[model samples]
Target chain A: MTASPPQTGGPWRATGTVAALVVGGLGLALLGLLLGRADVSVLGAPLVLGLVWAALTRPTEPGEVVVEGAHQDPDSARVRASVRLEPPAGSELALLRVGSPSHRTVDVAVAAPRSRTVGVSVSGVRTGRQRFFSVVHRETSVGQVVGTAAIRAGPVTLTVLPRTRPLGHLPLPPRLQGLTGSHDSRRVGDGGDLHDIAPFTPGDRLRRIDWRVTLRESGRGARPGSLTDLHVRRSLATADAVVTLVLDSRDDIGRDISTWSGYAELHPEEATSLDIAREAAASIAKAYLEAGDRVGVVDLGHHHRPLRPAGGRRHLLRVMHTLATATPSGRARPVVRPPQVPSGALLIVFSTFLDDQASGLAATWCRHGHRVLAVDVLPPLDRGRATTGERNVYRVVDIARADRLWELERAGVETVAWHELAGDERTLAIGLAARARQRSRPR
Target chain B: MSVADRARRASASARVALFAERLVATARIWSPSKSRPLPRVVADIGPWVPVWLVTAVTAGVAVASAAIVTRGTVPWAIVLATIAITVAQPDGPGAGIFAVTIGVLLVASGTEPFAWPLYVLLATVHLVVVLSALTSGLPRRARFELALLVAPGRRFLAVQAVAQPLALLGAVVTGAGVTLPWLPVAAGLGLVVLAWRLDVRVGDDGDG
Candidate 1:
């Protein structure tokens, strides 16, 4: 953070109001002197005295203002910019202008001889990489008649992340790897799922012995009705699943069809398609990570940015930070297919099926034996701003998108609409995970 | 240059080109539109409504008082109305003109010094000027904290305190039939010296 230079903004220039008062006062008193009307000079006394006081109290030293930034409250979009004002002696009010989207400006009368932090609120800001604390501030001298030069402090670069919804059950990989995790693995070990029933071995614990089975086997053995051999129950080992979230940042189109073209940029305040994709990817990653599964993130448009699969609460934050860096790229290096993930990792592709490129890549992943789940991140259609020709073009593109989605289904890829997931009901997600678990069951 | 140098140069150019593309893509982050509904980010102009209303009413009061104090005729009233229009604007020069006009009328009307009307006009002029300065040069929907008025109020009181006494002294000197030609010059010189004191650094490494 940088501080505004010491007001060294040159001497405080007198405002027009000060000149008005001086001119008015001097004119009256001089005229009274010429006419010997002492009453008139008396009448100008207040104005003259007022000007003298104002001149005496004007700011002398150049005071610097350091804008100490405060982050926006997570629950709201109002960014409270806390500015610390170190005003010169006898300075009056401070004017701060927060220039960006809203161009909100505020005036606060700060009493001198002490520093003060004023919080100016900025609302309706869009998510993504944006600037903050770009405050142009100056303190007023007597009566705000004169003040220091305006100084701009900073345009601090901050990446505001997209909002993520808390998702319910998310699908997992076919073969979980970690021995100590949430899902049941087919490896023979002690766990919740039954693996086998057999005579107890030397290494098996007494807790594994099944009393009814032991008695039945003993009766059938040489020692009738007596415990001849110990029987035990064996269960499958618990393992963790790996899930990699692939985000398609090719285009961040908004609901308005007209703005989809490269000529017009989407409104920064509204949630664009990339925002939806990031939010959906974050939600899915969080859900899988919460289940003690290893989760990763990859940008399809920028293959250079990738996070290897890892399981932890910290890793979830890393996933979110990576997602926030996904700029709405219109032109990126072209690729034949999406980046590869770990073997048997669940690949969830978050994309706007505006074209066949994303669907084709997802199908390729599915054909490569990775369970690919496609999430549609297109905003709902509201053709209020579109012309008749644009609307017709949208309808044609919409149909082609639907066909591509159908093609994905045929290619064994499940497409989930991110926005259509109503409330807390996640039956589709639960079913998908349950079906994967069923497939991983032992014969 | 060798073949290796050409390859390296090509890679650097490619990187630069990609950077330019990304920059161009995000050139227009946001733009205001009538069709797109405004985002719900506090953009509240709620604080300025009362300030503007108060300023308008005060300007009206100043105009009415200026006319009444001067004992204005029809032509004077019309001139005062024009001044009122000037006062309606931000940082208007109307306060100076109105004050001077009232002073001219006081001299013409043979009004007694230290009269109640004189006091009334003085305070009214101050009020109008200060209030106009308070809302000067700000854009529509600009906000101002109420605490900002504290300094202006203090300055107003301090000025009035000194000015009222001088007003009485001038009246006494003239009433007693005394002549002091240097009084006006001395006040003028003091005004100059005081004005020169602006932005004078007096042992301040500002701990403000």
Candidate 2:
């Protein structure tokens, strides 16, 4: 449905009204002077009144203008708007504005009722909910009479998300597999393993006590029998491993894109690059939870996203909630107050991998005994698309960043260069699994 | 008048005078139209030029304007001659320009016959003021360029001697003759800076 006409107090209408008043007053004054010598006092007032009435009671006809929205480019985070004005039947419309500083206006002309549409395009918008409040139409006859109308379009919004990349054959963290070497089930229960014998406490299981020792001890003396049965026992109970995602948030975001040529494209509801990283980190948390491994999220963006290192469904959900709500500020330098990290916690940092600060923060986490994984969100360079200056700048920044990366590498931060869509949990989980496999080798 | 009355009167007059002086200084520093030292150059030229050039231009303009009003029109020949010497000596463009303008004016009309001989002393005075105000020395780049002039390279000295004075002569003559409205000079300098910036991207196609 078309919008109602705008209230006629805007700059254009004000100018129109002023022009009408000036012309009318001057014409009336001229008429009064021409008829000055005659008895024309009564006629003069009527003449002035008629002009004023005509100027004030000018009729405004209504019309419609369609405002079209679309993503102008795959890489651009902006939406473009094209406004087309369609006037009434048998009218020609001109001087139409879809959106003004205050209100949009259109001026049109009609020859026995004819109608037409005019279109204008605006570009170079950033990410947000953009609104086109009203379409303004002003119709002017060849006789210099002007009428105005407005068509309101929308409270439309465009969500621009970061571009995604494909994940293929990327490996998971090493320690993701269950604790090994301490409990091999095929070796047999207490066969070449120690079966424990202890003083029979109140809640001691009767199955584990040695019957002959207990009987002999009870017969020999009234003292409580120390239940020590000589049998092999498993020394290692099920040891829990925790995964903590340390996300970096201080880098400048790259250009946004919704799809990378597939159905499983990046979602635009995600706000920032950090939000994408949060989502990826949460996905990893989900995987670790499914693997029956304990998982928790340490939102480097949040001081309280939990560094407790506990894992379960509840813990995974906590991580997801933290990811959904945490806002990433642009302070990329490693914070002075280090996160309270549990020992042997795996820290996976999901990042765009475009800036040095993120890598630096990951390195800091690695130094503190956290197994760090750096996921890159940038695609492989498409040289044909980049300009010479852009390529040169990219090379310089890349080289400098490479030096930092080498430092992180030396510090034992497991650096993974996974493009945006390339960072599904399978790739991360496999990477962890490979590390686990390598660690489990017979060294 | 009584001593008490006189003291009160003196205090009131002193306060009024102090207020008047503050107003005058504020007006001088803040007016965009007024050609004060630092803001004048910035408003005219964008900030890419070395800060020393700004200081030099400021001092050079101040001293040259003072010399012109004190000493009438100097000849173009002597200014050109000084420019030749300064450029030949590898003098900085600013110093050379200032020397030439003052030198020519002295030589031509012979009004300030002393201006030519006093060029080195004026520059030295300006240099001291500049160093003191900056609270350090001139930046490395400016110092390096200035050192080239003082060094005993005959060709360098010759170029400095010629180019500097010629530039100074041109600046003064043009500044006085054609740029009657001083605002136009600022606009012209801005245009020149723009042209230089536009030229910088021409040869380098990101090759470096």
Candidate 3:
């Protein structure tokens, strides 16, 4: 996309080197004449020649700078800027400077055109729109004469999606739906795994009858059951899982409490809790969606930018794009009411849990019979150098926060600290293994 | 030694170590690390003060010194001052004028014929003016690129490689009262023009 309108060419201006040569030459010539020093006069020849050469070759036309690849992925976008000179004959060197308010400025120099591209790698430090404001191009001649032009391409805006980390198997909701899926349903239906055996009833499929069990029962005793009472194997049905991710975007606190005083002015390099929450939510959504489970997103603070439950690669992209656009709404209150999630769908709520609002929402969802997983996204606190009074205050706040989490656990809402779950492959593996063992054990 | 005396010595050494640590910290704050790149150095310096103002002041001092040594006429001083001001401006086309004026002032002073000290000082002043002019008002990000671009050019300007010996040889010949012919000067000028024309032609071909 065009960043800004291209600037028209301007007149060439003499650089310092050109000025030095001219001034030095003229001064020496005058001194030689007054002092009758032929050797002194002879020294000015090179300077005079340089001046004449500069005059002969001064650029008559200004150079044009065209920037391409201005739009970049914040995570891995490399911006390339190119300047194409109109009559590239007189120019010796060209320098281009690119800058944005949020990022460090970069300058690239290319020897006279045959236009070459200067590439700059940028880190995706923050989410939302990033704009590059100034781009200046300066060209110099062999005589050191400088010609400069400023090109204001339309500001290139790159929307940086929040980065995601690899997540292990996520907890499945207690209930499942639909006939076709990966997870086994407890009820008997047509499936791969046998559930139990019982006497065949009316409308039972002939193929389902267990011939071995029927023959064994017939030879059991004098009171053996008749053929009408044949046993049939029952299989558990497998159904798909639906997951709803709730993002608490009210507060974004970093590790340093003092830095939080100017929360809005914090640099993008310093990620806050909201950043972690977005990342966690994105990771969880990706893991489930990759597993063929339908995943949806709910922004607790922003009513807009919600994605409906769906499953596919395209749906994952939509969910990630929505997650990247998430910003803290700066609301002091919790969500007025728990968001509506589909029945039997697992609800994953990402929050810092600094206040009771997020925990209350998770508990509410749990009360409504939906399985809720509350993720504490707060960064670890560093209290190493704090004063006694400050430490006491922090202690009190930590205690209160811990009590809220305990209450969530008491209400049957499973709470997981993001730091504890982050990159912990064994936790999910062990949990899944235990769940499998439980399912296989005889009742 | 007594126990008290030993304890006092230990305390004194500890205080010295503490002072040394503080001194090093202060030094680090004032002096940038050598390994830092040009752009970082420019950013640390922060903000621009017009280069011309600084160049003007330095050039004025150089001119005043030349006047004192030459006992020159007021008109001569005026001419020198004007050249100095022009050279000081990074954008002005007065570098040749400034160099010529310095040479004339040196000759008029009639000090030792090949005064190496005077040449060295004048060269230093010229170097300062050129550097100030090139770097002033340049954006911080551009400073690193400018540094890279100017390296070869600066090497070309290091007059010691060719100009210093030529100037000394000419001074010695002139001191011996031998009148030089114009043929060599004419030939040199001809070669310069030929090189310039050749460069222009090559540039034109490249453009095509």
True contacts kept of each: 0.35, 0.00, 0.33
Name the top TM-score candidate: 1
Candidate 3, residue B109: Cα displacement in angstroms equals 6.4
Residue B76 alpha-carbon offset, candidate 1, angstroms: 2.4
Tens digit per residue, CA lDDT, model 3, A67-91: 4455544445233323333435566
DockQ, every prediction: 0.19, 0.01, 0.18
TM-score of each: 0.82, 0.35, 0.68
Model 3 docking category: incorrect
Clashing pairs in 1: A7-A62, A60-B199, A123-B41, A124-B41
Cα lDDT of all candidates, in order?
0.67, 0.41, 0.60
Q: Which stretches of candidate 2 lie over 4 Å from their true place?
A: A1-240, A255-279, A289-334, A352-356, A383-385, A420-425, A432-443, B1-208
Tens digits of per-residue lDDT for model 1, A238-307: 9999998888887778877767765664555567888888877877777788888999888877868589
* Cα deviation of A119, candidate 3, in Å: 2.0
Candidate 3 ranges beyond 4 A from true positions = A1-11, A15-18, A36-39, A66-89, A93-114, A124-137, A140-142, A149-155, A198-209, A218-231, A263-267, A329-334, A383-400, A422-443, B1-98, B109-208
